[model samples]
Target: MSYKLSRRKFGQLALAGTVVSGLSYLTNRALAETPSLNIVGIGSTPIITTDQTTIPEVNTTELDSTAPDSVSTDIKPVGLVLQSLITGKAQVLADKSTPLLELNEIVSGFTSLSDGTLVVAITPITTSRRQATPTRITFLGTPVKTLIVSGLKQNQQLGSLLGTNDGRLIGLVGKKNGTPPIRLVDIDLQTGEISSISKVKFPNDERVSNLAECPDGKLYTSLVGLNGDTTLVQLDSNQKKPIRLGQLKVNGQAWNNGLQSLVCSATGQLLAFGAMRYETPNAVYSVDKNSGNMTRLQDFDTTQITRARG
Candidate 1:
């Protein structure tokens, strides 16, 4: 169920003056404290890869995980909003019985502060829909604090986002009109300011489908080819080009570039959510960093459920 953000929690989030820094929820001690988390396998989903990243073999059903010590804190699942095409609002299915957050602006995407606080990018409810305001809010209440992210231009629109281990926010920058060069931009979470980091020029008009920051201090993005093949690439500032990691395989078949979303779990696992083309239900899968294999955990129909984040 949904609950209000407590005063103690609100006081903990002061992003205006002091810098906010901490680990992601998955890497945080909260999820680690759990004695053990079991994963039920659904046979072997092999991924052919020569990359060094390790992909553990485990499978589990669709799980609704909560904060470890949430009873006293009234914490809720980190929400990822999927805006409806018709209504232009977000809906999440974490707690199916609870109501969704009725946000006022178009939610571009969300990322977390180092301290586990969530920040959202929204195109403000004005006539112009170019730049977005980075916002931090009380999960349960109506108090929303908007921070002025500096250097964001009027022609750039923010897209999918992720928080890094270094306490920075990285996102895709799409042009408001024509096909401007696709680039990865960084946001100073402490200052609410944005800046261009690097240009990710993918051939064949392939854009960043999903992006996440791993525990090893590297950034990864999923790129789909024109032939429907999906490749996982790494963003290395030291290197001159994006390192091609490997291809993502689903159910022993080449995944046809339909990855709905990808997020790095607290424990460093690459969690992916996608539905097959013309498939009735959606399933959750985990990507092995070392091997590009994706094993299906469980498939469930979310026809009634909307958007989920965190």
Candidate 2:
């Protein structure tokens, strides 16, 4: 029961042990800080906290296959879930949270104002008809007031809504004219007035699923094509054609149900949320703005999520 080793061998072994121990500690700390979010229903708000790590991550609640299919393109989102990355909890902004207001319409877009007021674009339950009404809600799901956007005709469905740094809202809208062209509209927070910004006719007119304003003032959005292919694109004002970054490729590509949401992190990384349709794992991936490659950050052990509170 005696162990003997040369000075060099002993030094190498000690260094190896120290490296392993350091890695183990950092790994454990990360695990403890990452929030395990379980969104059982539409109202389950899982707050994401910054105390654990700087990178934003999300988790979803477990559900059975029989769980309601809420990720379909035709399905209108009833409510919004607001999750605070700094706090790591989600506020379910649904009927249970705001019982007075019936959130049965399609939530076209959501963004937070400069003063932290959550703005939501809501359309009719059936389809995009005329002008969709916008509402301002508090972080706790309380309805503050509603803004009537003018000049937007009836049947115009707002696609992607984003709040810019200058306290203005930018959104993608369909005019519902003969050939509805998706255009970007600048919304006035005070008057609820929408002014035409740019007519964005994407390549092949790819339907935009979501839009997020990056830290660098560029618009990043997710586009879904007719072939069930999803991609990330940059909608810059100076560029006539939208810049195609790359495909939002995940490990379980076949299992991904649909694009749920796309948000930009504080550090300017795009976070994409995908719903699991079949027997697959739901995941939240950090997307590369340049390459469109998705790096898996956290796996959600859940089925479907209605929407998050803005």
Candidate 3:
């Protein structure tokens, strides 16, 4: 549905911060008003920061009224999916792969707060001649406050944001230029500052894909090897090293394609979106936290989704 604010409301939003143009302000409000458990995903698209005036308004379409029992009764269906394309617009998907809203900036990762508000990690576009820009931590609620994250180097970017049960915001910071060690960090929501927690040392040729926090407060990560072998690892809260869980198995065999996104539902079920091979159709899988075995839940289109949070 189209969301247009009155001129008075527009003035208020403009004064608060750089207002996100178009229906995003009202669309976000609509999402906030309705309370439901949603699984959010973001696509991998390079975005560069530009003048606000040059950005176009966000495009939106009517949402599907029927929320189908697509995935399963126990788990929530994929609700909001954000994809950044070459057009510099972010598309939101609801039930089908249909686009609902088009945003100006690229959303790399997002997590929900205790109050159901969303904390999003946005990476601004970088030009070939310029160094990478700092990722912005945006709180999507009433005022839509945004903060430039500090303590990240020029070649580093934060993804896989997870809001812990105790209210701590954690993220995985990875290097852009080379395969440097990926570090887990605590992000200060108020100050947009980050402090190192521990470096995730993967086995030779293994790289981390995403991170998730379960209801019981345990953290998990999906690692991909050079041969496309996928492994699930657990990060103990008090320990510096990660414990290797098994390879993510499907039908008693290792899932060849890596899991692009990992999220733990409120019901304590681990879920992920991955394919059997690269550039194939994606499917939702219920992951066994203990054994890393996966059961297929639903299938999706060939659209490339990079990260997920529930």
Candidate 4:
């Protein structure tokens, strides 16, 4: 007495639902100019290169270094989050169970393959998560690749993974204990492997927290000055000396609290970074990568911008 829909009716309903989703997305985007289309204190927003068009998607912890997955841009009606936030569903990974990969056993350095596949740089660890040894980069069935040194390994708790374009892996930009602070690590896209680069030499020796590669391939870093000033730094594609871009200030506010994270958009025009503030919800703002200027893009009243009734 309950099941009444026929196969033909079900197919029609599915198609109708997709159309409705598409329409709702369009309706929501029309008012996208209102600030608050973003989340503060979360992670960076990523826009995957599609055949055409750049869509805003939010990065969730699930897509963090913990899993090998990616969501597509320019391919969907939309998602609830801001990433290349392709609103519909999570992108499929070649191997669902592939483990997380970190840079120098500390930072996360992950990037997508040319076809948008996620490359994970996992080291074989004890079930308890102790680092026994790091393995050469290779997908489970792929041929042996040279991304790891035979007998050298370290801790697995310092850094989170970073993802980049196909040929290159995500590099590290953080400090290492009991050693001169190392700033960056390079990932080999071909081998799913990682290699340490050089530490940034700052006369002031600022405590840098995170680094992000903008769509233009320029690595933007979040540096905290010794004097407790939070600022933005732009590096040459080579990631050498960071040219001081000054602390990110918006609407007459000082960035003394510092940036919690950094992310950039496809055109490099929209750079988003999170500010660390305990009392208020985190803040996400857009920056002009070239001029180092920032615009207020979000705040706690975001629901005033995100809540919509269709």
Q: What is the C-alpha lDDT profile of model 3 across 1-310, one tens digit per residue?
A: 2223346543432332222222221123323332222353344322234554543332221122242211111111112333211111224322222121123334556666655455667664454665433466766444545566788887777777777777778888876522447778999876678999776565545667677777788888877877778889998856656788888988998888777678776667777777887546676577887788887755544232322232
Tens-digit lDDT track for model 2 on 81-199?
33222213322221112211223454455655554445556554444465333332112122234444565666566645666767777777774321235667787655556788864
User: Which ranges of candidate 1 are over 4 A from the true structure?
Assistant: 1-105, 124-143, 148-155, 176-180, 199-204, 299-310
lDDT of 4 at 196: 63
Worst 10 residues of 3 by lDDT: 69-78
Off by over 4 Å in 3: 1-38, 43-106, 125-127, 131-133, 199-204, 301-310
In order of lDDT, best first, we have 3, 2, 1, 4
Please write out the lDDT profile of model 4 over residues 1-310, one tens digit for every residue: 0112234432332231111111111113322543322211111112234567643332212222333332111212221111112122223211011122222221122223333233333333345555443443322112112244232345432232345533454444333321225445665444334466554563346666555665566666666665546667776645456777767666656566655446544435444444445446544566765545667554422110111100
TM-score of 1: 0.57
Report clash pairs, candidate 3. 1-62, 47-125, 48-125, 49-125
Cα displacement (angstroms), candidate 4, residue 244, comes to: 1.4
In model 4, the runs with Cα more than 4 Å from the true position are 1-31, 34-114, 118-162, 176-180, 190-192, 197-204, 226-228, 237-240, 299-310
How many steric clashes does model 1 contain?
11
- Winning candidate number (lDDT): 3
lDDT at 96, model 1:
14
lDDT of 4: 0.38
Q: Write the per-residue lDDT of candidate 1 for residues 223-259, one digit (tens) a residue.
A: 7766667888887777666788888887678887456
- State the C-alpha lDDT per candidate: 0.47, 0.47, 0.56, 0.38
Residue 97 local lDDT, model 4? 16
Model 1 scores worst on lDDT over the 10 consecutive residues at 37-46
